[model samples]
Target: MLRSLWEYRHFILASIRAELKGRFARSRLGGLWFLLNPLAQTLIFSIVLSQVLQARLPDTEVKAAYPIYLLSGLAAWTLFSEILNRSTTIFIEQASVIKKIAFPRLCLPVIVWGSALTGHVLLIAAILFVFLFFGHVPGWSVLALPLGITLISALAFGLGIILGVLNVFVRDIGQIVAIVLQLWFWLTPIVYPASIVPERFRWAVDLNPMAPLVRIYQDALLFGHWPQPLTLAVPALVAAGAVTFAFVLFRRASPELVDAL
Candidate 1:
């Protein structure tokens, strides 16, 4: 699959471009929607939760600390959830093309990842500009964003492809994943800081794979600090394992995927 994807790399790139163009083809805002949606979500969350969570934030000179933290975390979460959500239905949505074309099947998830990462970059730039206005721009640690993004995208795509394959047969799998992602969002602490979690329930936070990944973004963008290397151990290992499993499952199920569609 890797070689096949590389061999058809141009197609993957073109498909990503086509997907991006098609998405905003008729919309007036076009690419601005990428920045607006996340910005709007960050604003809504900040207004509703900032008052309640303000006291919990670290003592910072920056007045917009909470909003910065929320935006950084949301940027990471949006990239992750976007890929996961779309991957679930990608095959089903493209059933017509799948039946008609003979391109690399792996291209679907790669295309989703590329398109999502493009939007994520825009959101990150907007978040950084907002941070700049508040005198809280991230330091050199901002360079580590690609590493964080790679892990998050890998994990999301891995899990997404597995669920997407199952979704073709079960149908309920898609709905279940939708509900699970909602629960997963709250569980990962995008709005609230992990410090606010009660001592007894801290174990649940620690158990979440995304907790560490999201923390990397928050630390770098909000606090302008390099992530503790040890913090990435779990999610990195899990992402590797998940990728291995996803490909194995996808490769084995390749033939059946079309028939199921």
Candidate 2:
């Protein structure tokens, strides 16, 4: 797998650049929209939850600047959700190229994941600015940010590859993916903190691949603490399993993928 990814390294890089350019090619705001999208969502969520939902999770140590807490979790979730959502149709959207080109089809999902990860970093930077303004300077635990993000991206990529291949044959898979992601977003503790969950339910939340990731983000960025060992272990193992499963499925479906296209 390392060899394959290394061999296609240039293709992956070029695809990343191409995806970024195509997204902002003619837009007035261009890359700015990346920061704006997450910021807008954070603002709307924070207001609505505080006002209407009266939502507040107990035992989560968010400072007086509550948006920082929400934004921290929101950034991680947005990146994971966006990559999974977009990757479902990545190959189909580029069907013309896939039909004509004989390059490694795996690169398509990787590129989409990379582009989404890039946008995620930009959003994280914006969130960091918000934290700084609130006098919450990031501590050394911030170093874990990249690892957390990478794990989330790997999880998203694994699922994306499987979905992208499946969508090629089963058109309905894309619609199902949309609905599943919507449900998955709520299941993740992005809008609310995991600490509030009862002891019994806490295990289930932790079992979610994304649950540990969001906790890591909040731990490092919002709470100035290192991620617990179990927090990292479960999600990393899940991501590895997901990637393995996706690669096998993609390999098995490669021949038919061409036919389906």
lDDT of 2 by residue, 75-148 (tens): 88888878887888988998999899878888888788888888888878877877776778878999989888
lDDT of 1 by residue, 1-261 (tens): 999999989998998889899999989999888778878987888877776554447656677888888888888999999999999998998999999999878899889989998888877887787777777768898998989999999999999889888888889989898899899899997888888799998998999999989988988887777878898999999999988999999999999988998
- State, as a TM-score between 0 and 1, how close model 2 is to the true structure: 0.91
RMSD of each: 1.4, 2.1
Ten contiguous residues with the weakest lDDT in model 2: 57-66
lDDT of each: 0.87, 0.82
Clashing pairs in 1: none
Weakest 10 consecutive residues of candidate 1 by summed lDDT: 52-61
Residue pairs with clashing backbones, model 2: none
For each candidate, what TM-score against the reference?
0.96, 0.91
